[model samples]
Target chain A: MAALLPITHLLWDTWRGNLTVNPLQDWTFRTGDWALRLLVASLACTPIATIFGFKQASSVRRALGLYGFGYAVVHFFIFIGVDYRFAFDLIWDDLATKRYILVGLVALLIFMPLAITSTRAWMKRLGRQWKQLHKLTYIAVPLAVVHYIWLVKADLRDPLLYATIVAVLLLLRLPWVRTQISKLKYRRVFQKL
Target chain B: MAPKKTIMKIYSSEITPEQTYYAQSQSRRQFFKTAGLVASGALLSACAPSTPSTVDPAPTAIKPEKPVTAGQTDELGDAITQYDAISNYNNFYEFTTDKQGVAQMSAGFVSSPWKVQVGGLVNNPKTFDIDDLRKIAPIERIYRMRCVEAWSMVIPWSGFTLSNLLKQVDPKSEAKYVRFETLLDSNRFPGQRDRSFPWPYTEGLRLDEAMHDLTLLATGIYGKPLLPQNGAPIRLVVPWKYGFKSIKSIVKIDLVAEQPTSLWMKSGPSEYGFYSNVNPEVSHPRWSQSSERRIGEMARRRTLLFNGYADQVASLYAGMDLRKNY
Candidate 1:
């Protein structure tokens, strides 16, 4: 339900012609923006649940991942179907030349295996290996952030902010790092004693 | 009522394929209208005091508050982007990188009582007041402006030819290039503080390119004086080149022996070039220029060589490679 907001707004804007001068660009940006936001959100669930001791928060991680993949597919479809008109040669050229597009495509492909095996049946079939394979999200999330970084021309504030957020989230997920942080907080207390 | 005349027809050659593409554009064409356009036209017509508008004899000239005759170009049937859209959404990076932020920031910019220095390798070096330029140049033209970002718009611009201004200050035999400099006031333009590239933004044109009839030194569009955000007082309008080539709020015009390095060319030599012509065949390093989204329209149209002015300006690049130069 939360994921439908970007989709709904896109529909509303398209209907009213509310998108800025470049409607295609506006549409592409919004869809891609949401996909990245959701990817980041899914990555947060584990650390957020562990740190806050909110066991129930862990349940929404798969849902967020699936929804992010949905938006990713839409973003990819818009690029190819509308922007390129399914021109394979043009797509090939963009993929070859544009480093941002290449990174973005790699990010999208990373989500494919995780999304396909998201269902309970596939999770059960894959068993213990599923957890290790899904760890690829750590790599995918950073690539997606890098893709955003390359697209921006001058202003780096927004992209830099997102990078910082993703970096912090990744740090919180590392068990060794979390233990070190926990010890640092108590280190000063022990010295007082 | 003022008589609307088809001003000057420079190109007599056969219509190019690119021109035909604009005529029979695949997408549905919709040019939006704004109340500002009609309002400005009426205001300008009311302000003119029955004197001839073409040439003011004195240096202390009145602001060009009147509208120039903007007649349609022959065989160019693309619907124009309305006054408001053209005025609002733009890439005047001097003010701010944010498209919408420029208007507010540039409101305090004092363009009146401005001086443009025309110097360097020219036979005669002189600085002309902005008002004086208004009195001398009264030609207006409707042109299609395409940005390097793969977006475009058609606008009715009121101004005069760059050649007319260039001829006034005759170029010396050694002058191979014409370099332009925009007013670099960091006080008003916050973006100037960013030292990512050189400040006092610069652009250049080969001597022959500067002499082209299509090149214009525009003062206003849709009737009234150009809004502060739209490069108030004066700016360049190079139709065939990327919109960045049309530097805003120009203050300096230098005729140099060597090809002057423009802002983008200086910063990113690979991505931007000296000859930034509109070409469907040659793509930007990051994005494809094969197609562009017309500002008011929903669908993208295939980009054109010299922005459909190939027949007129292609001769300037005869026997030379465009891709390599680009």
Candidate 2:
């Protein structure tokens, strides 16, 4: 429910004519920003569960990833459909020349298959290979972050802060770091007892 | 009450003759050409400094006309952007990097009784009161302002040509460039405290470019004194270049031989260059600049070369490669 709040607010504000001077740009940024934020949140779920001994956090990981993917779809659609109006010739020039555009497109392309295979049926059919395919999250998330960093003209604070959070989350995923976190959680539980 | 066939024939006769329509278009084009010549002539005359003997000698504010109606448009027939949008949507990084926040952040800023120090490689160095500066040459110009972020606005700016300001303290023969510096108060401008940006935003222009008739030292927008967020008291307005080239809230003007590295250039040398002209062909490293969404307009229009000031400024960079310069 909280994940849907951004889109809901976006729609409400847009309908009310409360967007900034440039609504299309505002929509583009808002959708893209929410997509990045949700992806980061999704990535944090597993590590958060291990570190804090909250197993429920792990359950919503798939849902969060799907929501992130949904937002990414909207962001991409806004860029090519509404904003560019399916002007593939202009978009092609953008993809060929603009580093941010290329990076963002690559990130979205990686998310497509991950989103498709997220279902239980595909997971069961793929069996052992399912986890390996999903691990592409490692590449996709960082590319998304790079896409953001590249797009901002200056004032890297917002993007860099996101990059740091992502780095910490990625570090926590390391086998050694996960073992230490689990150990710490056990120690805390034992002390409580 | 006429029969259907007769009615159709009557409607067809009412259609405008193709020849007449073509002639009307030709006359309209001719009218625009004449208007262009007249507007440029008026601008040139307005740029000449008002001598002490010919005009009001005492220091006084250069007041611009009241808010323009929707019907009043720029020479290019672009509608003047609404003052509300212009005021609220600002890119003054001194207050904040967020465009929407600058207005509120700079609410309490003090721009009155401002002093602009002019010196360096000049025959005479002096500090001018803002009122005196305004009296030098007062004119209202509607210019298309294009940002490097691929957004644009048609702004009605009121101020004097920069040439009039430089004329007071004559530049020495050796002076090759003009440098402008913004206020550096961290308390007033919260964004200054951020170490990420080198504070006291600085920008420069070649002496010739600075002296161009199109180059204005804008003091007002929409015929009202500038709001703090819009670089109150004084700001540079170079229509041919990207918005960043027009540094805001200026405190110092120095005539120097060496090219001064603008804050943008210093921060991102590879991405930003000295001459940040509005050229669609020269795309930024991060994004395409070929198209820009003018404020209030949904569809992105193809970006024009020099923001459609190519006729006046093209000769300035006749031989140089803009791609390399940019």
Candidate 3:
């Protein structure tokens, strides 16, 4: 339910005529931005659960990943469907020439299987294979960040900041780092209690 | 009206139908009615009247005419972009990098007491007041501004030709290029504080490009004094080149012996070139420039070589490799 807010806010802005002069660019950027943020947030869930010992955090990871995938689909739809008007020639030209768009497409492709197998039936069927396949989140998040950093003309602060967060979250997921931090955190919690 | 009549002679080929132009003009005026009320109210309380306005120009000088003339559109017959969109959406990186945010960030910016210094390798060096510069030969020009980011706008700008200004300060025999520098006050322009860019943003053009009659030193837009975000007081309008080549809020003009490296060229030598002419065939390093979305239009149109100004400016770059130069 909370995932609907970004699109709702965008629709309200569109209705109010409060969008930027180039509404298409605004829509594309906003949707892409939300997709990246949600995907990164999905990546951060396990790290948070391990480090802070919040067991409940892992439960929503699937939902967050699904939401991120949903936004990515809309982002691509806006680009190829609305903006390009399904002009395969122009779209093909962009895919061939534009590096950032190509990277974004690859990242979206990675998210697709993860989103499709998110159901409990599929997850249980795949079992350990599902976990290994979903590990591709680690790859998808960084590619999305690279897509952002490459697309921006000069300012890299926003994208770089996301890159740093993703780096730290990934570092925390390392077995040694996770076990050490988790032990230290639980020990401190018991002392406080 | 006399000034308007004379300026129309320059763009006598404008072929927009009379009825379509009238309907557009009527709706434009209606938009201005609401926009002007809000603008005047905000402008009155926020800033003093030191900023020159076409609303009340000196009786002796040519003032920008309104209701833009019948069939007065760009050479491509593209309808003039709405004044609100043109003013409200800007790429004045001095204030902010966000296109729509520049207007709000530049609120109450003071462009008064501005003096543009014309010197360096010139026979006659002079510093002219911004107002005096506008008086030289202010005329309205409808131009298609294509950004390197694959977006474009059709704007009606009011200013004199850069050739008129360049001629005043006669270039020395060895002067081969013209370098321009923006005002460097970090306090007024917050974006300068960021070290990512070499501030007092600098840009340059070849001497012949600077002398082209089509190149304008714009001081106003939409028949009004330029808004702060639109590079008020004075800016350059090189229609053939990408929009960034038309630098804003200029303070210094130098006729140099060598091609001066512009800020973009210094920052990304591979992406931006000295001549940043608009050519669809030569794409930017990261993005395709084969097509562009006009500000109001939804679908992308084929990007034109030299932004549809090739007829007038192509001779200037004859026998040269535009791809190499770009």
Q: Which tens-of-lDDT digit does each residue in B247-266 have in candidate 3?
A: 99999999999999999998
Task: Report iRMS values in order.
Answer: 1.9, 1.1, 1.4
- Candidate 2, residues A107-131: lDDT per residue as tens digits? 9999999999999999999999999
Query: For each model, chain A TM-score?
Result: 0.92, 0.94, 0.93
> Every model's DockQ, to 2 decimals?
0.52, 0.61, 0.52
DockQ ranking of the models: 2, 3, 1
After superposition, candidate 3 runs with Cα above 4 Å error? A185-193, B1-72
Q: lDDT values of the candidates?
A: 0.79, 0.84, 0.83
Could you tell me every candidate's TM-score relative to the true structure? Answer: 0.83, 0.83, 0.86
Best TM-score among the predictions, by candidate number: 3
Tens-digit lDDT string for candidate 3 (A1-193):
7988998999999999888889998899899999988888888888778666688889888877888888889999999888888888878888887899899999999988888888989989998999999899899999999999989887788999999999998888788887898789789889999
Better of 1 and 3 by lDDT: 3
lDDT of 1 by residue, B100-197 (tens): 67777777888989999999988889999988888874665668898988888887677888999889899999999999999888886778988996
For TM-score, candidate 2 versus 3, the one ahead is 3
Q: How accurate locally is residue B261 in candidate 2, as Cα lDDT from 0 to 100?
A: 94
Best by DockQ: 2
Which residue pairs does candidate 3 place in steric collision?
A: none
- Poorly placed runs, candidate 2 (over 4 Å): A183-193, B1-71
- Looking at the true structure's interface, with contacts defined as alpha carbon pairs within 8 Å between chains A and B, what fraction does model 1 recover? 0.39
